[model samples]
Target: MKFTRNASANWKGTGMDGKGTINTESKILNDAQLSFKTRFADGVGTNPEELIAAAHSGCFTMQLSFILTEAGFVPENLDTKAKLAFEDGTITTIHLDLEAAVPGLEDTQFQELAQKAKAICPVSKLLNAEITLTATLLS
Candidate 1:
């Protein structure tokens, strides 16, 4: 199967004084505001790094579930956090932290699966920056 997603942004006026809105085809984000203050200084609304992190976290979580199921393990719960680091106007790194509860799964097995997901997930492969993963198995 093949799929595509699209999001568009429109900005007007100068960088410091201008404002923009982002809209996604899914409509989950409708006319979301973004500006220089929002990107650098911490104002209201979402920014690019925030959106990237959300996508990474969501994709990694789903990939982990698929890997666990394929290995005959049922995933009870999986929580993933993606931290994106931006420096000098460039995205430097992405860190993924995963907390998982899987019944009847050993630490070694869980770690292997998490590592595979981190390496092979679609979003992970698409990123050019460094990617790190920390997996914790919860009882």
Candidate 2:
């Protein structure tokens, strides 16, 4: 499967003083505010890092869901959180914390499938950083 998705950003003025709005093709984030304050400080809006984290977490969870179904395990719930670390103008690491509830799924198999999803997810492949995962199977 091949497809394309895009988002646009508009900015005005200097780096620290400038403000911007981001629009996505899906309209889920239409005209969302973004700025230096939002990125570096606590401001009312979203930033690149936050968006990346969202994308990574969503992608990883979905990928794991597919893998689990293929392995004959039905997932009751999969909650994933992606934490990105940015320092010195670089994204250094992304940590994925996953809590999963799946009936009849063994811990060893769950760990292997979670690791596989983390390795092969499109967003994980797109990023150039140290990726780590901690998967906990909930009984």
Give all TM-scores, in the order shown.
0.97, 0.99
Q: Pick the candidate with the highest lDDT.
A: 2
Kindly provide the TM-score of model 2 when superposed on the true structure, using C-alpha atoms: 0.99
Error of 1 at 96 (Å): 0.5
Write model 1 residue lDDT over 4-121, tens digit each, in one string.
8899999999999999998999999899999998899889988888999999999999999999999999998999989999999888999999999999999998999999999899
Evaluate residue 128 in candidate 1 and report its C-alpha lDDT on the 0 to 100 scale: 88
In Å, residue 8's CA in model 1 sits off its true spot by: 0.8
Clashes of each: 0, 0
- Stretches of candidate 1 above 4 Å error? none
Give candidate 1's error at residue 33 in angstroms. Answer: 0.8
Evaluate all candidate structures by whole-model CA lDDT and list the values in order: 0.93, 0.97
| Ten-residue region with minimum lDDT total, candidate 1 | 40-49
| Candidate 2 segments exceeding 4 Å error | none
* Clash tally for model 2: 0
Error of 2 at 102 (Å): 0.7
Candidate number with greatest TM-score: 2
Cα lDDT tens digits for candidate 2, 1-139: 9999999999998999999999999999999999999999999999999999999999999999999999999999999999999999999999999999999999999999999999999999999999999999999
